[model samples]
Target: MCGIGGIISFTTDLGERHRTADEFAAALHDRGPESGGRWLGRHALLVFTRLAVIDPVGGGQPMVGRSGAAGGGRPEPAVLAYTGEIFNFTDLRDELTRRGHRFDTASDTEVVLRAYEEWGPACAERLRGMFAFAVWDAAAEQLHLIRDRFGIYPLHYTLTDEGFAFASEPKALFRAGQAQPVVDRDGLRELLGYTPTPGRTVFRDVREVIPGEIVTFGRNGLVRRRYWDLPAREHTDGLSETIATVREIVQDSVRRQVVSDVPLGVMLSGGLDSGIVSALADREVGAAAGGDRLRTFSMEYVYNLANFRSDEMHASPDSPHVATMVEHLGADHSELLVTTDDLMDPAEQLAVVDGMDRPIVGLETHVAFRRLASRMQPTATVALCGDGADELFGGYIWFQDPWYVQAATFPWIGPFHGMEMHSGLVDRQLYQELDVPGYIDQRYQEALAETPLTGEETAEDRRMREITYLNLTRYLRTVLDRRDRMGQAGPLEGRVPFVDHVLVEYVYNVPWAMKNLDGREKGLLRAAMGDLLPDSIVRRGKSPFPTAQDPAYRQSLRSRLQTISEDKSSGVAELLDVKRVEAVLSAPSQGLGAGVNRLSIEAALQLHYWTTECGVEFKL
Candidate 1:
């Protein structure tokens, strides 16, 4: 893994423009600590900070091709700056070699450059990995940028009058002077009410290159086009065959992502996704690298053992489950215990939103993982996360609907299905003042447009599609974004093996019946687990990363709300009435569903925090 940044221009001075690229790359230095370089030309420049993952000694970027420009029978010399790992590079390289493409380095980055030279933009469709790359065409004066199909790797860009500026993170663009501090109101609504959908960021002028999409720039101006998307296909395979295929694809993905020079590990949540990854990685890598087994990391709160409980609706606590899986797998494991006080720190939410560039749900667990990354970075350069499994395998309890079973695709829509619960929790004027309906619905409509279903698509498939679509479009993006920021913030590279293209494609076509065979969510996945994970862990219901259940966390949030109320002209004050907030705080029964005691008070606090601290000025 590495960091990529660049500047493309038609008339901008090459020497001066190169400085912008340098600054952008510098801002991402933590992402690539091993080596760095810059590629410069009259009309274009590219820069890279490489963390020596694959071909440690040989791979470096901005990697310029040895050949000269096309025409005059000369091969086109393309310079590439990339940040990611191509898990299937061995196969890709063999195909490229058979086609007479010479190689000087055993690096997937080079394979991609050669592949692009051979297939142009079409190359992305054949690639199966998490990547964000930018290429400069010296002769054509054109620049090309592409992102992975699931948007696992982030690439933010800003278009200026002179040319285009891009980077692996928004902060890099800001540092390059291509970005100004403009806030998008709709983006704020999404971040506060729902997960910020893929392809949208907090920054107004900056845009994310969509998953499976390519954006190109030249004298004609910028053109954006989709290179890949989820193919709507009818499932015909039996449950057994589908499960077998899923096992093969997932295992291959895990094995391929273990191709780093630096030590690697997995975030073993003791759930099926993480457990499967840990088991496969320990077996595959231990065999390949002699006795070096996969390392594992997990987090639990202090006093968690006492607070742990399980019901039919929610699974048993993750700590014990994760412990059993780690012991069964016999992998080197480390667990960090955070206190409710640690999670309830006054400034923790602010730190998260500041680093993430937006507010997100599940804030406490996100911080815990980040703390784990910082601690484990001494022994691991990359950490694998099992993020996409839930979306692909119908793992969300909300997705078990019989209606979704018969529907064509994603049935996870209608997230705001029951706002009526808020009617008596808070005053009517407060509900109207909050205007959660107008704000949330607008963002929801925008998200639906991003992954619209056709008439030919079934309701079951549509629901499944919506779930996985939102996973890719929102949930997964948020997870990957948090992983990148939190991990790379400490110079650690976080890899998501489940987001591999091959695995994603296999799951995309598997029918909902296969995903949840025998009335079990992710039943096929469990069947495929075989000897990798214990049946107890495999059959366990989903438990999100552990967070504090203590009342201290709630009080911490209420304090922040109090602070927000004190700041008379704060952006958070505009939407939330002070009287309503006081009333809600006094009642102590709002912000949650009926029979649900504690609320997502921290989430509400972060919403207020984003407005005041992040300057998310509201237009509503």
Candidate 2:
């Protein structure tokens, strides 16, 4: 795992290339603190900071490699600035060796370089891991940017005066003066809309390399080609066969991902998804004698156990379920407790926003994960998470709710409509100008148009498929982005085995009935891995990542909002409706569980901090 950034200018000379690369590297220091390197060419400059996961000494970047076909009339060598692990590197390496490719290091980076040399951009199709990488093809004078199938690792790029620049995070581009931190009307709409627009970011002119895409920038400007996508296919396998295949693919993904040179562990959430991963990982690691016991980690609130409240989102505290799993697995486990004070700390809140590179409404979740990553960093350099399972297997409540499944908008947005009153607090005229509703409708239609279909499924099947696609392609991106930004900020590499494209592809075609076989969310997943987990965990309902339920947390938010409302010169003051803000601040405390109060307060506070701290220039 590492941080990669670079500039590619084909028409103009970059005199300050070294300085720009240095700034980019420095901005990404936390992501890769072990080592750093740069490769400069006439038209391209690549810089990378290393986390030293595999073959620490030898696996360095920007790694340069000569194309296997580099002779006669071929292009020059390709230089790769890459991040994320390639679970199938050893297998790909063996194939490459058989095809006469020589190896110099036991690193996936080299395998990726050689694979690109052999297969060109099509090599992205063969890779089966979470990654976002850049390959400056010296021969063709074209720069190729590729992200994994699920966008597990982030890569953002923007068109520059000279040519273009790309980085692991948008901050690097801003820090390098490649892109400005400006949010226009559309950007603000995106910020508040909660509907993800692929290839677009909250910063204008800055675009993300869409997941499962290869974007090439060269003499002709730029071209984007989808190297992989969820295919619409008919399922012919029986129930038992489907279950067996899922088990096999998931286990293989876990087995492959455990190939880490540094200390590794699982982010055991005591849910079906993470429990399955933890169990499978334990088996894989324990297979080798003298192998270190699998380490597990979970998060809890300081007073959650004593004052826990069941709401629509969470059924019970994770500690009890966590304890059950820990004892059942008999693995090394650690629980990190987060307090309302921690969630309300100005510095911690700002850090969460900074890590996300945007204003985050889920401040508690991000803060907890950020701290959890910090705690895990001391014992693990890499941790496997169960992120994509929900999207792939119909695990969220909206997936099972008919209201959401049949809704015209994104499924998750329906329930949140009543809960998300922050929009009402925005300046009325400014909110009208933003047209967040129209923007969301437009984005929803666009996503629906892109939904792949077989043209043979029943009406119900088609709707389910569309819902699944929206979850995977749109909603899941937010989840993965949070994991990547927070985990990498801790300098910990987070892997999601459930996101393996092979697994996602196969499970995506399964009918909705089978997916919700027992009329429960994630029923298919439960059937496949239930035996590995304690029966209680297997029977537990879907509980989203826990939030601070303490009433003090609500008081803290109200206090902060009051402070912001009184500060005349506050950056976000002009954007908010003061009367509305005061009303929210003065309203009786509803505790933090009410999505409306919590999310509204969080949005206002985050917007204030983001605008003030990040020096954001709003062009509305």
Error of model 2, residue 512, in angstroms: 1.1
Go through the candidates in order and give each one's C-alpha lDDT. 0.72, 0.86
Determine the C-alpha RMSD for candidate 1 after optimal superposition of all C-alphas.
3.8
Q: Residue-wise lDDT of candidate 2 within 255-293, one digit each (tens)? A: 999888899999988899999998899888843324667
lDDT of 2 at 79: 89
Top model number, lDDT? 2
Local lDDT at 29 for model 1: 80
Model 2, residue 227: distance off in Å is 1.0
| 10 residues in a row with least lDDT, candidate 2 | 587-596
* Per-candidate RMSD, Å: 3.8, 2.0
